[model samples]
Target: MRILIVEDNALLAQGLSAMLEALGNEVLGVAGDAESFVTAVLADRPDVAVVDVRLPPSFTDEGVRAALHARELLPGLPVLVLSQYVEDTYARELIADGTGVGYLLKDRVARVDDFLDALHRVAAGGTALDPEVVRQLLATRSDPLTRLSRLSRLTEREREVLALMAQGYGNVEIADRLVVTERAVHKHVGNIFLKLDLPPEDSGDRRVLAVLTHLGAPRRTARDGRDGRG
Candidate 1:
């Protein structure tokens, strides 16, 4: 993957660049602030952007703004937003943009494997959320989405697919992971969404938004499909 780091912390940026590069992915540029980050986005055109939730000047949502702008400017350019501090507003906004985006805590970086895994998933047009952020979204749960999220009377394999979709995996990759044909994966995905009571909208990677919103709702039982196990 071709990755860009839009972070102000010099040490963290360099460390991330080194690690991703070591993982055999291209490290395009590491920017110090929002302007430079936007510049890097235009110049490098990375397949994915790993951004800090805060940047210099205000140390507020500059990175989030840049991420949203980048998504608008470069369609299908997935972004992974990270922060040392916990926040849900940004995560909600990100999900509101649709899927192929990730919001993770900086502490997650300590778990390099998990962090990279999330990065790959995001780049491939999947969604990844910090557990805390998920909890926060759950607090504002919508009745419709919440009700639908409970409809998955999924088999273990179906649940695997559903969890992966919530994580932003495409059918092809999901099929490969489960050692099934992409065609079969597609059928399973369709079934999962149908069971969830979601209207077919874009029917693209943006589908992750619906999935995230559902998963973040109150947990739902797989069997009952009427009670709240997710």
Candidate 2:
């Protein structure tokens, strides 16, 4: 995979470039500021872009804005934004785009293997958000079940699975965490979708949609969870 690195910190950018290269991906280019970041992406059209949430000139959210702009130009272009802290607003903006994107804390990069795994996931058109980011998101919410009346339909174990899914765990990982077979996880996922009236999707979009629904945002529900006898 060809990757573009957009970070103002020269040392970190160099380190990330080296790490990605060592992991068998080509480094397309490195950009220090917003303008240069957009330029490199548009010119090179790499397979993925690793961006910092803060960039030069103002260092506010230039990196995130640049990544969004690049996505506007090249829709579905996978990009992962790294931030120093858990910012719900940033995560919401990235998730709102509803495409190949990720928001991870900078600390995650130290876990080299996991960081690379997340990068590859986002590059392959899947979502990868840091667990802390997801936790903060849920914690900041006043009522996570406000819009999700279907919550009652899910068994406690299924609710557990959904929580982990919102944290960006894949089936195998969730199974390992829950001490269940992957098949069992698959079953619960399907049932959750059915109960929530969400169409199954392989690209991970539906899972995120379900998470959004679980987080009190109303989405279309196709069926009632109860048999109407209760």
Candidate 3:
């Protein structure tokens, strides 16, 4: 995969570039600021963009704004945003489109395999959100009644499945984590879709929709039922 990186930290950018190249992916170039980032995007049109949440000038949300603009210029452009901390608003905005996007903490890059997996997933037009980001989204609710209304139909097990889904885990991975059969995980996923009123559609991703629904609702801890049949 061809990748463009946007990060102001020189050493971190160099390290990331080296890591990606070592893995056989083409590192187009690293941009130090939002302007250069956008310029590189227009020039290279890379398979995926690995961006930092903070960049030069303002160091607030320049990377986020640049990423959003890049997508505007090239719709469906894949982006994997790296942040030092979980920024709730930035994460929500990036995943709002529900395709070819990822938001992860900078600390996650230490686990090279997982970081690469997330990059590849985003490049293939799949969501790869940080578990912490998922938790924050689930926990941030404006209206308690609205949250209850949305997720009231979900069983405790279904909520557990949905939470894992929001963290971008596949059915097989979720099954392994939950100590359930793959078939059982599939059933739980289906039930989640049904309860959330997310039907199978030829267009749009139901998994992403389910995750979004899970994020919209208030956080609910699932009962310990991993030993029971899923």
Those runs of model 3 whose alpha carbons end farther than 4 Å from true positions after fitting are 200-205, 217-230
Tens digits of per-residue lDDT, candidate 3, 75-176, equal 778999999998888887777644788999999999988898889988988878888888788777556676677688888888888777876778888899
Candidates in order, TM-scores: namely 0.70, 0.82, 0.86
Please identify model 2 stretches exceeding 4 Å from their true place.
142-156, 190-203, 213-230
Q: Pick the candidate with the highest lDDT.
A: 3
lDDT of 2 by residue, 24-142 (tens): 88999899999998888889999999999999888888989898788778777899999999877777667656546788899999999889888888888777888887767656555
Candidate 2: worst-modelled 10 consecutive residues by lDDT: 221-230
**Local distance difference test, each candidate:** 0.75, 0.79, 0.80
Question: lDDT of candidate 2 vs native?
Answer: 0.79
For model 1, how does the per-residue alpha-carbon lDDT over 1-230 read when each residue is reduced to its tens digit? 99899888899989999998888999988888888888888888899999999998999999998887886677667899998876766776777665578989999988988898889878877778776665555455556465445643665677677666655567887898899999888888877777767665525555666666665532223352222211
Root-mean-square deviation (CA) per prediction: 8.2, 6.9, 8.4
Best by TM-score: 3
lDDT at position 77, candidate 1: 74
Candidate 1 error regions (>4 Å): 142-165, 169-197, 200-207, 213-230
After superposition on all CA atoms, how large is the RMSD of candidate 3? 8.4
Candidate 1's error at 70, in angstroms?
Answer: 1.4
